[model samples]
Target: MNVGIGLPIGDPAALLSWARRAEAGPFSTLGLLDRLVYDNPEPLVALAVLAGATSRIRVQTEVLLAPLRDTALLAKQAATLDRMTGGRLVLGLGVGGRDDDHQVAGVPLTTRGRRLDGQMEVMRRLWSGQAHGDGAGPIGPLPARPGGPEILFGGFRPAAIERVARWGDGFLAAAPPTWAGGLFDTARAFWREYGRDGEPRLVAQVNVALGPDHVVDEARAAMHAYYAFTGRADHMVAGLLTTPGGVREAVTAFAGLGADEVMLYCYGTDPDQVDRLADAL
Candidate 1:
């Protein structure tokens, strides 16, 4: 299985440093998490900059909250990025779980799932050179491909997996490998149910930190703070892979589950961790 690295939470200099180092490393993709209510960098814009700075590794949003953005604008931006980056963007989309995010974006929380479904439909049409209105011309800056960039759906719900068959090219699993086999199975079943051409790509994510004891501790603290909104930070932190052996084992386990890629979410902002993870792999 291929291994990808996630952008750490940090300032501009630190982020660019990590991205540059990550590009030179043996990583397959560079991923970023999304949040509008928080102080995190906007995933699309940040990724565009990182992609501009590097020519090799693909850039992805681990899971962007699609319901929070205007559908047409997002389609334009995604298509532009896809063209600019030579079709290296993997749009992992989700109906967000945060009430504050929806509230702040003026989108009702209860309608997010349905909104995502409609948004995907509209975005696909827009990306395919379809006009938005009766007299309106098609959105400019078409994507690098016939459709838009590759799309992956994220969530643990049945509807989310169904989206893989309906609109997405793959499933971005947030669960650990041990608990993810059934989810992947459901995704495949839906893919066949929909008469999709081939297997739906399966990608798994894990929180990882490697270095001295202090770095691991800092990584755990960062995860706890980031995911505290879920009320399961301790449980999540307890599952973190802190050693090279642990990372290797997780990769093997995910590969055994037929994952196409494994995204290692590094919670710390040290650029050196790029080499550390590459060496470990």
Candidate 2:
């Protein structure tokens, strides 16, 4: 599996520096996690800036909450970023689990699944230069790739896997490496069942914290804040690895599972987290 790092979303001032640090390290991709009701940079905009900062590293939305945004606008944003990044953008779509995100978007949570399926069709068509509603012309600054950025979706539920086989390039899942093998197996099985012509790309991501005693503590604190919405922050805190040994262990375990890429998300936003993880992996 290829190793990648998430660009820290906090401290917007330091975001680019973190991007540069990750690009300079052993990371193959720089990823972002999207949150609507949180203090975080808008992910697509973040990539627009980071695109100019690094040339070799691929960029992805670890998983973006697609149903929350207007599909046409989202397609335009992603297409522009793909052009700017030289086709390095991998779009990961999902109906986020947070009810508040849907509430704020004025989107009914129950309809998200169906809406996302339609949105995927719309976005892919728009990216392919298809004419829009009425007399609107094809989207400009066409995607760097002819068919548009490679697309993936989050989760491995029956419906989600069906969506992937029908429209997406692969599956993007989040779980500790040790717990991911079964998930990968299920997705690949469904990929074949649907008669997709080739193997589906599988991406896995895990949360970690690797640094000094203080930074480790800070990392846990950060997770507590982020997962507070789930009412299981304490549960998540207990599993976060805080050492280089733990980080490397998970990466190796996931590599054995055949993940196309496994991204490590630092619980702490310390820019040094990038170098530390690269060294560990």
Candidate 3:
């Protein structure tokens, strides 16, 4: 399985130092998380900065919130990023689970799932050089490929998995490997039903921090801050792997579960965190 690392879009100092270290680290991909209505930087913009700063590392929006932005605008930005990155882009999308973000966007929390269903098609058409019905043509600096990027959808419910089967090129499970394995099965079943060949990409994510005694506390604190909007920070923060052994064990487990890739998210963004993860690998 391939290993990737996520850079924080929250704290600037942490993002800068850790992004540089991560660029030099032994990771196959570099990624960012998305959110609005917070002090966090915009995800696509942050990704653009990281892509400009690094070479040979695939950059992506690790589940960009799609329905919050205008569909055509999102497509243009994604295609632009694809061109800027020389085609090293994976667009993992979802209707994010936070109500505040939706409120901030002035869109209803309800109907996002349905909205994304159509949004997916619109983005594809724009990427394929098709114009919107209003005579607005394809966005400039077209994608490096016919389609914008490899599309992956994230969520764990039946409807969510069905959407992945219908529209996405793959599935991204933000849960633990053991939990993600079941969702992977659903995704595979739908892939075959849709007449796709081989397999759809399967990616897993784990929040992590590696260090001596004080690192666990740091990681825990970071998790609480990072997931504060989730309303389940206490439950979510408990999953972080703080030791090298735990990290190795989780990687092995995810590989066993047939994951195509797994990304490690560092909440605190200490430079040592990236180096230690690289050494652990």
178-197 in candidate 2: lDDT tens per residue? 66888788788888888989
lDDT minimum window of 10 residues, candidate 1: 9-18
Q: 126-237, model 1: which lDDT tens digit per residue? A: 9999898788889969999778999999999898899999999999998888888999999999999999998999999988999988888888888898889999999999
Indicate whether candidate 1 or candidate 2 has the larger TM-score: 1
Is candidate 1 or 2 superior in lDDT?
A: 1
Candidate 3's residue-wise lDDT over 1-281, tens digit each? 78998765547556656667777877877778787876677888877777787777888677899999999889989899898889888898988878888999987899899899989888888888888768776665689866778888888997888777788888888898879889999999998988888888998898888887576677788779867876899989888888889999988999998998989987764668889999999
Which residue runs of candidate 1 sit more than 4 Å off their true CA positions? none
Model 1 lDDT at residue 30: 91
Q: How should the candidates be ordered by lDDT, best one leading?
A: 1, 2, 3
Q: Rank candidates, TM-score, best first.
A: 1, 2, 3
lDDT of 1: 0.90
Give the clashing pairs for model 3.
none
The lDDT values for all models are 0.90, 0.84, 0.82
Could you estimate the TM-score for every candidate?
Answer: 0.98, 0.95, 0.94
Pairs in clash, predicted candidate 2? none
Give the top-scoring candidate (lDDT): 1
